[model samples]
Target: MAIGPTIGTGLFIGAGQALAVGGPASLLLSYIILSILTLAMTTSMAEVSTHLPSQHGTLVTNGYMYMSKSFAFASAYLRWYTLALFVPYEITSAMVNLGLWKPGSTIAIRLAIITTIVVGCNFLPERLFKSSERLFTAIKIGTMATLFVLSLALGLGGVDAQPPWGFKYWKHPGAMNEYLVRGVWGQVLAFLQCLFDGSIAFAFAPELIVHHAEMPASLMPASVGEAAILSASIPGIVKSDVAQTAFPYILSSLAMGVMAPFNDTRLTNNGTGSGSSPYLIGLRDAKLQIVPTIAMVAILLSAVASGRSFLYLSSRTLCAMSELGHAPSAFSTRNRGNVPYLAVVASALFSSLAFVSVKIPSTIMNTYLLRLVTSACFISSLVSCATYIRFNRRLRAKGMAKRYSSSLQPFATYFGMVISTLLLLGSGLWVAPNGNLTGSRAIRLIVSYVNIGVFSLLFLVHLFKDFVSVAEVDKQMDLGGRSYGNRAGPREPRTQKMHPHRGGVYAIPEASGASDLRVRQTMFTEP
Candidate 1:
């Protein structure tokens, strides 16, 4: 699930754009920096999940337990909504990929067909979903390994092209490419551009650690460490691909950084589609006929797998909302197969929004969707950090802080919060070509941050329905639960009892005509 959609066009197709604007050295450095920040987020999430594992473990639940009810409501809605859009975005990208094989195809039909299939698959039993996810993840990993080896071979002068590519372009381009205003300011802007542009690739990934937070502390160290390391490696490997093979493959068609010029007509400006991918470009240049086809098919399958996973996650998020009483109880309903089919279908409906892409230019829609996703993800990351800080405080209050690992604690949480908050604030600037806030600029800011307004509205709506004081929220929180003792510091051979119907720390009255908002606090316990 983490590896599938994550390795989609963002790294494969979008890396070229990052390479084009930031050059090799700048892109490489920026990615390394972002990777650390991403690790900070993953580590923080691991701590919370370790400390407070729930059947529907989410920042939303953590928010309610450690913060205000309003905060919880906003977090829950934001996550469900943000995650819902990903289904359509991946589907749309897949349609664009299909365009590569058959130009001017009817996108609407293809999108609907694909979305239906993804939604239908979610209705299957949980074990089947897990099995298929494992298969897709394995295939995706194999694809990446193949890419690394093939690109490495190409970099070693596998083709009888120019001189053996050994960072030759890096010397010519001198690593960094200048952007926006010139001089030192331009360099600063160029680096920031790379940072912002490259960020989308890693969005929502750190949250994956939460999925495994229920495991034993001893088991967590490896999974938590591996999640961060794997995510951080994404940009490094892709940047290396461009540095070694993509840029060097067709130097004449590309700009100074050994990548196609920023304005290259072939580049997928929308940040979707593999038609113009640097890896595909290298494959084409090397005259590998069958391999390029296989690579494209792999990309398509990755998109499908990612779409499927997003649906699975969306349903889970909805279940969390239902359990928290922020969403309709119907969404909490499970089929005989134990599938939250209502939430699955509700989430899949967001994919219908992809039809809007059919009318708008692919590049325009891509930019809008990319910025939207980036902003929401940054907001969600900050929420995670805040929740972790509050959770730690509760642990310390109960004298359990020492019982848990503080390896990267407060520092990473604080650092990630600050960085994510700053990025979320400035994310709108990327939408505007010039920094000036003109009419289009103003609109772009609103569009990019529409999620913030929506989240705030959600908080207000919750306030109207179930208002609670901050003091009460903290006082009622169940910090003393036995689940908190399941930290990494201690281990027991006793068979831990599994309690599926643990009560919540607090409950809110249902708003008028909001019967489905009835709350239940079901949690996951390790055995």
Candidate 2:
């Protein structure tokens, strides 16, 4: 389930750009660092969610539960738009894969076709959606496995008369490329750029995984035991097997580094389809035919599938926000299949942004969208880390027994917080006075940091409107425990309750005099 939405055009196609700018060494190193950060963030979330799982999933709802309403409101919108923008990012990627990288009616037609299919799938009954997701997830795993094997074979001289090329490209390109400036600082910048680029692939992956695990049992796929295991033993499974859990991502990164040299012009070539993929470039260089086209087709399908998944996630996030009064309440309405059709339509509208590529170059458009989404991802990560810290402190103070515990606690979350901040701050450094800054460069600079401005705007606006003093918020955090509401005075301790549908135990604050319905209603309702 994690791999379903996690692996997308970012790895298959966008990695080419990273290779071009940072070379193989930086690409590999950046991915490793990202893996570590992903694990840290994932385990921290798992620890929190497993202790007091929520029906609304872990992102902004957790912020509301453990942090402040303003943070939650800001992050809810931030996450909603982040996932919504991803629809176009993936759609634009599909356009690139279809060789329609230019502006025209052709791009428009293909955009409409892909958007229809993606949006249409979300309106399906819940069962059909889950089934389609599983099918596409299987295809993604198969494609990754095939690419890994092919990359390994190519590196070992499996091609018809080609000699073994193990590590040759790394040595020739000297493993590190200078960027912006020249010298050690340039290499540092190159590595940082790689981190920023690579982050797009892993963005919000942990949240997706936790969200899937938190899904009602009826909505989960039958074959996905990992979700069940996550519900039962998230801390143990994530803490002990983080490396194993991350193996596919790590292996895919290594496979890309081995498939082609970073200096290959094809890696940066703004040409059609296969030309933009380092893996496909390697296959073409081997004098092979048909296979590259086949691989491109697989990648196109993967992009479409990823777009569909992100659409579902974004819509659900919007629906959750609506339930909390952070968005229009109409979004909370459901159709016959229990799907939030209004939220789906609202989120799917952003897919039209993919048409922006019709005017701008697809590659450039992809990068801009990537930067926008990546910045939002950094903010989400920062918020999650902060929520985890406070939640952990609360648990410790109460001497509550945790369903999941990690040795990396607090430390892992702290590390994640620092890395997220550095990446967010450095994301737009490319426009820094390396040379003359043109109008286009100025636009790029604004696009890079625009999300940060938007997040601050949302937070301040909500902060003023919410108007709760810090002392009151802290007091609520202390007394409210697992619930988030405006209720005052001492309350009874939280009591364990069995979830009727999920068959798992959950905690709810014991109401001193409130009715059961009121207690349940106010659990996730805003103050």
Candidate 3:
């Protein structure tokens, strides 16, 4: 749930953009398409989690046996580092939104502020730390629900029935084929945005849960699932009609216009992320009298939630890498708070470059574009899924003692890999063909090459340190629980038998490969 759902969901914001690009009619089509795609990806993720779930989710242990721990560490490092690029950007966005610090503040002063807050949080007891975070999450959710309810109210009695506030814009929409590419591209980008949003927020949550003193034994195999659930909660908390704005795709519907403004009582523009994406813009266009304070708070909260999450994730990855022997030994040592002081310091130093670039965000169309939060993450996701498929396939083929495997062996793995690759490829091809001023294709080329390139270089340099054969890499995977490898093949008509209980909780040992799990020993450990 974390990576799949928790990733920075650009969906609501993306939906608005889809309406603009694909028009109202096609917007619905795009949502249907992407939702299916998302479901498929989630299934692949679920299958993997059912087997080799770990704190890093699918990224950590899927290929540990096939690749060296160093390889796993490298994948973890690059994804974390790439994702880390956004933390400073999120902070900068919120800081700017708050209008708290003066624009002319000295660099040292800003750094000191960031350092102080981060260090202060480290001093709090664990319970206080989490409670505070959950508080923000709750506030964000409340604000979102309030916005939807109010938007609906305004939208209800032709609320404030104003000019440019009806469904006229959508009624003039074109054929789906006309805006198909635009719709597809726009929504795809939105999905990518959503992925980054959710992924960044919860990527390290499993690691966070793992450190807790009393994690549920069931949660041990659910670290990854937990992340997905949290991610899904955003959409879950808000009804789909409201949440759909997170992606916003209505051609000529009543929703075509109408957005609440800065004041509490007026309707204006619905801000879409794209040209027409600013929710504020929608509120304004509706001529609603929304106060500006609402926008500022939303912006600040976005920065706080998104920024802090990414920073913590980056630090965790650094620590994980150090533990796995991928980076300098200094990172392995944790401080009194179990914080990886050296790794945190080192990562903060590297992530600081974002400060320089983000400050000069005039280099791009908007401050947000500079984040590049999702560029490399999708690539890493594809790699992680593929590695699992590959590792597990070889195991099943040899008739080895399969501990925890998926229902269809590596097919699910292949499915995820192919789809993720296709999405990335589609984006890549789009960027490659139509170069932007920044030439994001060039940036992608650089990021991927550096990973593939540097890893190759590093591997060559330290070839003698640890040589892993395909066979050895195949052996290290431990699907501690929930193995479905031996299940009957999918029926022509697949059926799910979910016998639910009160409070929406149902429990049982439903997996096929129970032999690999030791219930008495490791069952009740932390997630």
Among the numbered candidates, top lDDT falls to 2
Residues 1-527, candidate 1: write the lDDT tens digits.
Answer: 33343456566555565665666666666666666776677667666655444445556566777777678778878888887877776776677566765567577777778777778888899888889888887887677667656666666556555344545556775667777677778777777776666676676766654444332222222324543444334333323332332222123112213433343435544333123555566676667768888987886777777778888888889986786566899998998888988888888888777787678644455556667777899889888888887777777787774223447767988899888887788776566464222237677778778988888898898776543443344344345422333544443333333322333322233455221212245554331
> Which of 1 and 3 is the better model by TM-score?
1
Model 3: residue 195 alpha-carbon error in angstroms: 11
Task: List candidate 3 segments past 4 Å from native.
Answer: 1-34, 66-71, 92-126, 154-156, 161-166, 172-215, 218-277, 290-292, 357-359, 362-371, 398-412, 428-527
Q: Which runs of model 1 end up more than 4 angstroms from their true locations?
A: 1-6, 160-163, 172-174, 215-265, 269-275, 398-402, 434-439, 467-527
List TM-score per model, in order.
0.76, 0.83, 0.62
Clashing pairs in 2: none
Candidate 2 differs from the real structure by a C-alpha RMSD in angstroms, to one decimal, of 7.8
Higher-scoring candidate on TM-score, 1 or 2: 2
What RMSD, rounded to one decimal, does every model reach?
11.8, 7.8, 13.4
- Distance from true position, residue 459, model 1, in Å? 1.4
- Kindly provide the TM-score of model 3 when superposed on the true structure, using C-alpha atoms: 0.62
Better candidate by TM-score, 2 or 3: 2
| Clash tally, candidates in order | 2, 0, 67
User: Which candidate number has the best TM-score?
Assistant: 2
Q: Could you tell me which 10 consecutive residues in candidate 3 have the lowest summed lDDT?
A: 497-506
